[model samples]
Target: MRPNLLKRAHSHNKQTLNNLLHSRGTSPHPQPETISGHKQIEEETLPKYNPDHWYPVRLGEVLHHRYEIVVKLGFGMTATVWLARDLQADGNAGNRKYVTVKINVNTLGEEFQKGRREIAQKLFSANPKHPGYSHVRFMLDTFKVKGKHGDHLCIVYDVLREPIDLCMEKFPGRRFSCPKLRILLPALLQGLDYMHSECHVVHTDLKADNIMMGLGDPNILDHFVQNQIDHPAPRKAPDGHGRVIYTSCSDFGEPPNEAVIASAKITDIGLAAWGDEKNTKPIQSNAFMAPEVILQAGWSYPADIWNLGVMLWDLFEHFGLFDRIDTKPGHYHPEQHLGLMIALMGPPPKDFLKRCAKASIYFDSDGQFKHPEYIEDHTFESSIVRLKGEEKEMFIDFAKKMIAWVPEERWTAKQLLEHPFLTKEKEFFSATPSLSRASTASISSMIPSRAVTPGIPPSSSPNSGPNSSPKSVPNTTLLPPRLLELVPSVSSTECESSTNCEETKTEKLATNNEKSTSRTSLSLRPKMESLVESNNEPDVEVPNSKRLSVNKANKCSQDIIDAILSKGKNHNHRVSPEAK
Candidate 1:
């Protein structure tokens, strides 16, 4: 007989054997036998392999007699995710409902159990419909499965598509377009705001890997699953546990067109903590690590903002913002990282430097940086000078606010959502079929202008064309006074000069023929001494309404300056009084 015929015959024989055993009132799988207390103790003490190291469970195995293990999704440090079919699905034909099962290693003992229980309570007790929970992945149910290593804790979640890192891998470069960035940043921030404020949880770890692309349409998922069922991938050999590891056939193609890739959800809350909980272990990924975290100073929600900012830079530029190659073995150079930060953003505030435990290692007593070689002659503007259109300005401006040396100086997620860079109206999200027409329109209206111009390099000249200039389309919305202060706006002098020219253009032209060209050239100068001298000599009275706006703007600026001074003044303290 041919090999294919032989395999079919063998499968038929195995099925027949299982049927025979079922008819005889016995199970094909082995059952556990009762043992004495001494024997049980001996078994517990014996050397046992971790179930996750090898395939702990078999394909077709009924977990808790409801979810039948279908394929292995992936594995993590302490857990393994599997795609499983729900046996108890409500009377739907052909297609069965599938879920992701996360099985965590349970050999970690009592302390691990206590921590797991706390996390479970926090996750399970929360309201899923809350706005804070908007971009967060919600748990469905949990159970335990007894294995040779120990009992494994299994968590069930709605089947998500893939991680943002995986999505980036499929693209030509490991970068997403600005439109995608707009969608992704807003959703992530909304989730962060919810987690920080309503849930009172701090996700110490925020990165591309932890953020997952949401499975938008049920039909699309069903189709993907159906494809797997029709054309299954080849199975691998069984492990020591006599279980074959089956790889999932689900194809997570480049960022899928069917779903809004921006509709991402933050995952893996195992490392997360309650807002007030004190953390001993170092947190955050190396590249995204905040200065406070590096210095072992007490950090809070602001650390997360710092992480988000770095993540955003990675998303936009497809490179790590603070990534450095260490010259010394067994040690990362903090001075190099700090030096780069200082070079890009001015120097860290004196107060921020005072709190650093190893401040002398990098900075002198006078707060001047010691490592000049590590510093690059780069500012946000100089770095993004190549970028075409207003993106160069907007990106640098947005980044400056987030990558501040002082944590409190960083914009909160809520405040960042209102930024013009993110709010610019665009039709990018409209291409996603999953979003409704109304939703597409609503999102587009919030944006000030489209930031993305495909195939154009950042270094491209801003004067390429009239259409290329973002200034051609004026932003109609009046920004809040507070936001106006944060962002560099049209200077009052420029505004006054422009307004005056617009009102008196015809009158000026009529009065001057030879002087018209000279007058135009002089007026264009930003701080012409003659113009300034003339304006200063006049004692003009301002309207009360105009005076009120100016006063408010000044107050806002003063308050910001005072806050910085206050932070610097209390740098010697263990915990800043302002933090309280």
Candidate 2:
């Protein structure tokens, strides 16, 4: 087992609450070791674990004059979120206010555009007047600048302190309380309602991390300067001669002070979208997605409502409702990913399967979701992440309403706010200290936290779970980071060669090379095409929208129409089935 690769594997797995709850106590199982980086030492004399290669790009390095980068707040697949200061907050709310900047070098491709439409289109509440539309900005005022490569997009936003997840982590002693949940949820519901009614939007990625607190009434220019700062140029330090003194150390000086957005507005436009492919396919955080989303049924605000329910649950219960999904394929059947729903709402409605495009992998006959090849189960019994008391019941009730297999069955965000659980929060938000988040002592302690597949396996037991063991894939070699932008992914690899022969071709889809299954392309039957089909087909003329072309052909109105026909209502939705 090469220690460096092992650490990375461990870090990626940390996103799962199960790993956070119980993965540290287990012994390090030996792996197929490889040679890289430093020389191998005796097993008894391994060096300390290092977190070098992947450090957050100090906020200053990415942006220019407006704010300073304090520290990394969090990160996702394409971008890293930062907490920084805005120099123009007081006199120029028009300029620099504290902001959260999402820095992504990745091109965003289809995912970014889908999210843009979701939030730009509607709010994620049940009520016609969810407050989100009233306050949140659909598009982030942003700009772009040069990086080590050439260009990168920096999405500027009104900064907020801790995310809801961090807040829950800080508050350990309190039970998922009624008063607190009430105070918080209504504001959330109102915001969602506003977005839905005013913008016709839906935030498909509704997780604690995405919901923020800051921005009462954001000044209009809040987004304007953000655009400029994104691509700030490196300034030359006065060498007593007005000459620039370039150094390897920090670039942007006095980056803004990172803070909880004194008030937060809806952020992450890349995750919000307008159309409904059915609530079935959302590019959502695994822990918060609705069952309809998992089952491939039509979904819309209800999916966000389910996410809100989890947020409501987080107010009292520190634990996310469905944080224990097995990561490996063939562990349980795909249906089992709906464990929280099954546990709270009972068996799915009979038509649930009919709406689904059967899973590519499962743990057993019951059809629970199996882990993907890149993930592994490294849970340890001794490490326990606990959330007890009334909070548990509150979460269960919320989960029931949010994850019903039937889209219609799930509660709307507005409906959720009206529940007895959070009645008092109707008046203006009872401002809470975003900075106070949970107690540090409680958060500091927790159990810790994958890989390519060798083969696809089926389960013998209907009650089984995804294989917990790890497996290796063919290509683990690290390539130059530049490939992310310069090289076209996959198939282009063949074109890179000077020989340019048909041999050594790079395949595009799995079917091009292997008989393997993707989560979106699982046990598909011909009739299942309904999952991707749409009732109303647009004119033959193609609509012009593509952040990145899946291929000019895939962008044709007919192709999108076909996917809808095959996948059902959710096909046109911003949340693609291939959402990470």
Candidate 3:
């Protein structure tokens, strides 16, 4: 009976070997030694961190038999990030690859564990060769290791130099310059656009803390890694949960250069979700929350635009746009925040107010704040006191369009990309002439019919015949030739109606210009008449009061154009005043 059992076990082992060989597309028993060597190699390549006992992670302790912990990067609620060196990197001697390792403190919750796997799968699925991938922080690898409490998840990422918040802290007053903003905003928007469109994900938490400056110099990174290794700092005492706490320290002196900051990538997408998904849970930091989010109204992509507007304001002002007041021990005054929004952006449109579930709590039926005293002592004009003439006008104009009471009215990422503020440079326009042409076309299509008065003879047009009226179009306003030059060719019919038409035309141009330039002082030139054109529909007649408002807006825009042109001359920069 013993001999029969032994023979059966031997036959089963032989059958398993045969199956393995067949799976490898090899004949059974043809390469037994090679198969045994492959198995040995596979075992060696597997992670070595013990699952039963937590490894004591000292400053110099190696992880996965590859990475050696060098420096504590930072700590969050659930994890501590560490800078580590890849000891197994290919080199003759001493040269090592640096990486950021985020170690979770405890065994992750079911939701977080699922999120981590989803993120890893999505990141791994992305093609590294795509240019869009450059804007996002890609995961290097992930593994599980035993911790003091339980098994911890360790996520590896490319070494990012610093978070934007920390980087900004080094600047004077923690404010970024317009030039720096120009560089960073575009990169950030590009990253966001890719995430929204390509990845089909919405970064529910978009803030300075989640945006990081990319690697600058490899030598500098190596130097910093070596310094950490040479001078190991003691880890702080573990918390109640027995997880070690560590403070981030940087020995690499001085803030990063503009190039590094310009390459900022969005990180910390732990709260990210599908763009179309219904997220009932609270999202985004309170200070950056959109009105839709605050009121518990349905939200989607436009919510992100609102967040961006607030972020841009913070970048320029070095403070949050919304001031939160502690009404109680743990509660914040949401109504006060709404009042502040009203004070800054004016009241929400009636349609928007109707949609807001909490509108009645904060605003009266007429759209005035229910508690006016709760409003902050601030206005758009007052907030931008630090900016000069054109800068202030451009900033306010751009912000108003984005911080609209109605989420649907906010300019989309793609539309904002073509705004004058972003395409102000001749080089930018020259490189992407199609965008400028498309923008011009879009503006021209919005030209109000009031631009062409009723009872005006066809002969009264700019291309009128020799027998045309000599009155030369009533209330004609001449736009700066430079402003006219910036606009693409409109239909002869639209151009011929009236000279005063230029005011509304230029006002619309300024609005578009303001949209892009306010974030970063991009050179924006106003396009033609559209202020009276209600919501891009030309046939609608604008009330006299609205027309007057358009006139005032045009006058202000004209002033901004003159100031911008003057500033350009002072800086010895020249932008073409020629029509494309």
Candidate 4:
């Protein structure tokens, strides 16, 4: 253990504080029987899987001693994953700290090294001091696994016991409340920005199941194992359905139904680029591919926006817009993807579709999709998902901008960042360096200092309702446009009202940005009944004053007996704390 970390632990219970500050969602625990490896685990398991429970992977096993593997938190194509602990770890670490580790000397030979590099790059990017600030990024601590097969890189990270996807899965039909969803979006966006903007990387596999949350550091000797229960991978096609399902849309019979604002971080990258695009690898991009990417038209950053836009659409409608549609077939050529474009959207603009250069998209007379000859055996079906009201209008707008058949027409990250919906969320949930010693020390210093500018400027306007406005906010594109509507007015928010207030506040107060599940149900809230009512203002009641119009201010006190109420209550909640 680092000397400083040990010294700091003596003064501050950093471990407890770390647990309290984590931002993970609580997924339901499996039944005792199932957990113990003795029940019919749900279809969430895989073909080569154990249905009963979760297990952990610990790299520090031989390096240290006495630890055991507990559960498997996540898995990628290259390696198995586990959450582990060492009974004899240094300091109080033996008590059970969540640690994640990946065994490298498994499948996928060369790609393994690339994944290792990605982890290394991701760790560097995750550092606040690093040029690429990532929220969903992973950390890599190298370890050796010496078996008959030899050794390799084992990635390690803080463990996230519960994943948000499983949490949503347990709830089944209930959509996340606006505040709850907002809390997660910022981190997901920052994560995406890291992969896209800083790394020049594309996460071909962006989905709810891929994104994870973790707690603390995992040294080499932690308890670890692997259990194939509650598979977090994308769901597959059933016999009759015949189509692989990437997005889940559980319909709970209710009006104003909310969807799981899916937790998104790109995963399963480079599969599309690793091999011959013409040969078609066994791995697939599935429904997330944009038309430009599908057609292989010199794609770039906007391709990610296209995928994100589609992901948002799936969240709202419960299915992939282009899923089941055989956009491309016959040797997995990019040109065949045009079939998907025409199906999801009516048809691209002639100029846009004309970029096909290689294949025929239409007849000379109509410029319509005529000979879409790719799908022969399999009938193409548009997931023809429906959208309503504001969602419909907003989604279509974003879809047009993102899913343009032509790559050039797609919206850039800079443009999406400024969209009104996103701008509002960005403004409200403005992330500031929360755990800086300088800021804390300054606050504790006795000397007077210049007025500080708040990270997200507090609202000082009369129109301080739900979404006050999108002006004055930069980096707005961190959220999907439709979801941005609920970004609370940053100034007026309190722990009591704004659901996202907690996440935003913590991201401000601490850059560590732990995911926590603290929610208040209105029905269970304690009413302010004034228990000491005996001495309260009553009996000699003053004459009722006119209701304070929102347009005016009203302030009065006992100091002025003849004080007249002329102004309205301060609509803006930016109050300065008074001197003691």
Q: Best by TM-score, which number?
A: 3
State how far residue 398 of model 4 sits from its true place (Å).
3.7
270-313: candidate 4 lDDT, tens digit per residue: 23231112321222355666664443344454555667666653
Question: By TM-score, how accurate is candidate 1?
Answer: 0.62
Worst 10 residues of 2 by lDDT: 525-534
lDDT score, candidate 4, position 279: 23
Cα lDDT of model 1 by residue, 278-320, tens digit: 5445787667778877766556676787888778666656446
Candidate 1: global Cα-lDDT? 0.54
lDDT of each: 0.54, 0.38, 0.54, 0.36
List TM-scores for all candidates, in order: 0.62, 0.47, 0.64, 0.49
Q: Mind giving the per-residue lDDT tens digits that candidate 2 earns over 372-438? A: 3423332111111231122222233344445445554444454454332232111101111111111
Rank ordering of all candidates by TM-score, starting from the highest: 3, 1, 4, 2
Error of 3 at 61 (Å): 2.7
- List the candidate 4 regions with Cα displacement exceeding 4 Å: 1-67, 74-76, 86-96, 104-107, 110-115, 126-134, 149-152, 161-163, 172-174, 177-179, 214-284, 326-340, 349-367, 371-388, 423-580
Q: Residue 274 error for model 3, in Å? A: 1.1
TM-score of 2: 0.47
Q: Whole-model lDDT for model 2 versus the true structure? A: 0.38
In model 2, what is the error at residue 364, expressed in angstroms?
A: 13
